[model samples]
Target: MDTPCAERSESYIPNAIVGYGYTEMAMQEMDEQGFGSDTPSGARRVSGVSSSRRVDRQTGRAGFGAQFRLRFSRSVMPRTQKGRIAGAVALFASLGLLAGAGYEGQHFLLHDERFVVPGSSAIQIEGNSHLTRAQLLSVFGEDVDRNIFTVSLAQRRTELERLPWVEHATVMRLLPDRLRVSIVERTPVAFVRQGSKIGLVDRTGVLLDMDDDSETASKGAPVQYSFPVVTGVSEDDPASVRSARMKIYLKFASDLDSSKENISSKLSEVDLSNPEDVKALIPDHGTEILVHFGDSDYLDRYRKFEAQLPQWHTQYPKLASADMRYDRQVVLEMQAGASVPTNNTQTAEASDPTPAPIKHAAPRPAAKKTAAPERGRPHTKLAAMGQPHFPDESAPTGKHVISSKPARQ
Candidate 1:
């Protein structure tokens, strides 16, 4: 066993080993790693795996053994291009499996009877006043008996908002077999007359129809509001225009009501056609007198009108309208055709409708039957009926267009 030339037999046995054994350099390297069994220790130890480790002073492990272990670990996992391809393929296969599993799970949720919607009873609706349960259920009618996961919450919300009463709405899945619907209804601020039809409108100018309860129940839709009937806002007008008009109307009402006198309640209707004029019809004696509140200074004008009303009514019993656009002076119009005959009565009747009454109102020449009356003057028919008493309900009984803002005269 110690002989170096042990293979040199009689026939040589056709070189039993295919190639030469470890070279001198390999043997040296192996010996450095404490695995040179071919050296003097070959008969004593089979391999370096079973031998005692020679720990280094610095690393606390055999120097060659530790380096060889580090190198072996690096080589264990393939770094070749082919090996990388195989690893990538395995990663892709794992991802595909996960994706397939997720698809199947979602399909189950979408098709399972447990997740199917039973009926409208399974839906929870809240914050609805004018919106009826049946009307709301119609929006999700297609969802009945279908899996809840298949119902589009966003689509349902969009449909709900399209209703006249719904301002905005939120839809959510309650899991399993139910859905939760939260609605914010539009609040009607005024009664709007658009063309021939009368409907309720919110602050944003959205027209709404009365719900079944309000239409047929004890409380009528119009009975809910005590505010004046609004005119000039119509469906033909753009949303922006309607909104703008409503803004002015709201401001006028709010400012007048701020006094706590509830001065807006004195009149029955408000005309918003001319934003600059903002005319309000107030009951004067037996006639409905038009008062121009103008665009701003609502509270001040209302108070001034209240203070000077009796004086104006006392002088002109058939007062038709008073223009309050002027700060100091007001254009007064008594029912046209009232005779201005006597000097004392004509002077008092022709005075300004504002707080400051014109002093010594000179009498104008009596109109000859042959001559036509001057512009801005009442018709002769009205002048002939001295002290006329026209019955006025103070509410809009028919359609009428208010004149544009009068020119500064």
Candidate 2:
């Protein structure tokens, strides 16, 4: 080797190494050249650093452990922003897998029959007064095994409301295969009469059934009649009441009929001309009188009429008609009293016996021509009764005064 000044200064260079076979000074020169040197002193130096043989052997080539360490340190520490992003992505992926598994498990547990309502679960039926346990169960279809919690509440309520009698229903879960159902049943209130047949109805007029015992008992007790029987405003005549007004009429008729014996002879027909006015059509021999009942005050009218009956029957025995519509006045129409028989005997001399032989003096006065009654107010008859010519005030007490003059056509 040639001596050089560049080699002479190598020992002081930090990047240089010197050893083995080469003299210390020569090693120092090689060290100055930045070259690795081998030394027999049981140590080795490469590029100014001591290293294991494995490291020295791997140092010249790409190391798998070094690549692995770079990746592993990034994964373990996650110190850099890029490393943190990778770590977050991996953590999110793991969490997503776990969440997916948990969601699927919950879905399967709730919907699946094996996990939710098993076959061994017990069921209970409540609010079953009219319906039996079997009847209630049959409504849910044959697929259901009577496990209450296993079945959906919405499904069970749908089944219950379908029943004919159930107006409303509720289904509840008791847990552990137990179920409870409550029901509300429709109830009847009255019987709506339809010709010969009657249909059961509620108070609101909802039709339920025909000839049902529940409806009949709820509506009314049985009533018997020889003539026609009508319910719910069968007639629309002026003498009839409206449908909604029939309840009071039926009740009153029922009560009146109970006392038939006292009123049967005097009353020919019951006229409901005014629902408020119960007119009694009474017959006096050949003629009839429309006796107006004062009002709904039936007790007072009945008592007054009952007291007047005895005297009227005797005095007006042959009277054509009588009007007792007024509280104070009673009008009498006489068949015999109005027309009195007048006998005219003309005296003449005759050859036969008896009272004709006696001649009487000639009468010197002429009778005045009598005018017939004008309209219903008879002037002569009114004058004979010694009363001023005014309209008849023979109307029922409390009734508004009506004009006696006929309404012009």
Candidate 3:
């Protein structure tokens, strides 16, 4: 379809006339030979005609169609330096976006107005005991009471928990309107008598000087009404006061109950000041009972006394005082001149001498023997008085004739 020169031109020039498979193989050979269209230096220096006619020097393979195919393939391949720069820029932009998003999220969570606390419309107190609702409200301070938004529940709990009677406490924010506090108060065990005033005290001996109210006082506070009045304990010694008073009351109650069980009279009082030598002032029995109870172990000693009391009462009916200081032995103090078993230990000796019987004159109108007064021996004398030696009918009231009885000598 062309002249001779035209035909040569057509064979070397890159065209669509070449079949697809041959063009591909020829292009691969040119690519391996370093003859590609992407090299701007190569494109400008080499004439398109010569480049199309050039052969792959190593493979001896080439054609205009093959060179054109190689050029197209090379143009499509990415440049390494440019591609790396683009990828790095994209990564940086993505990281910046992520960091900005995270910063915004944190700001919202920490300081946004949405997270601010709502105003307080109601106050929910723990209780009215120990510390009243009014008193606790005062501790919350003006800021917490005015603007509820700044109220720190944790801080409030920390401040109140320092109180000795408050065992534990929790402060909670009631959403939209209120704050509620719940606290556990320590139970008062006994009331300690402190001078003219009484202090409410707990089992641990912590004194609470709060005003008197039924709720703040312990359940057993009223039971201390009949407590023995004690002195010498100072206001500074709240712990010692509590310990001493509780010990006395507990011992007295235990002894009284045990005595009733044993048919013995109730104890008027029990003193624990000297714990080892506890003494009980018993009823009108004329003497105190000395009980040696060491430490706070009166409960055990009282039970022992109860068990042995009935036996002693039956054997020693005339006993004026009983000493149970030593657990194994019971000492009895009896009325003067009363007969006691010889085996028993008598604490006191006999007081006076026994009188000798007088010899009466022989019975009237009966046989009489002449009597002679003995001399040199201790002389016995009987003198007559105007009112008679013995009390007569005119003796002062409340006098009675008693037969001569030998008293202790």
Report the number of the highest-TM-score candidate: 1
Order of the predicted models by lDDT, top scorer first: 1, 3, 2
Error of 2 at 351 (Å): 60
Q: List residue ranges in candidate 2 displaced over 4 A.
A: 1-80, 83-87, 94-98, 107-121, 146-150, 192-200, 203-206, 209-409
Residue pairs whose backbone atoms clash in candidate 2: 10-32, 20-39
Please list the residue runs of candidate 1 whose C-alpha ends up more than 4 Å from where it truly belongs after superposition: 1-77, 80-86, 195-197, 212-223, 284-287, 336-409
Candidates ranked by TM-score: 1, 3, 2
**Which candidate comes out best when scored by lDDT?**
1
How much is 367 displaced in model 2, in angstroms? 62
Q: Candidate 2 residues 86-111, lDDT tens each?
A: 98999999999999999997776566
Residue 143, model 3, lDDT: 34
Q: Tens digits of per-residue lDDT for model 1 on 1-409?
A: 6243232221121111111322355445544666433433122121333233333333322324321121132465568999988988998999999999999999899888899999888999888766667778899889899889878888898999898788899999888899999999887776665443445788887877654354224344323455565777778889999899999988998898897888776665677888888887776544566677889998888777667677666555556667677776566655444432234234443443322233333344443232332332222121111112234322212221111122222
Question: What is the C-alpha local distance difference test score of each model?
Answer: 0.61, 0.41, 0.46
lDDT of 1 at 313: 61
lDDT of 3 by residue, 1-409 (tens): 5455443343332333333324467655654665555632222112333443554433333544534433444644347989878878998999999999999987765565554444333668765466756566665755343445567778888887777667688888665446788888876543334443444455444565545443445443422222222222235666666466555555545554564563222443334355455554443333333343445555566666556555445544444344455544444444333354442222121222332222222222212221221332111111111111111122212211111221122
Displacement of residue 288 (Cα, Å) in model 3 is 10
| TM-score per model over all chains | 0.64, 0.31, 0.40
C-alpha RMSD for every candidate: 16.0, 29.4, 26.3
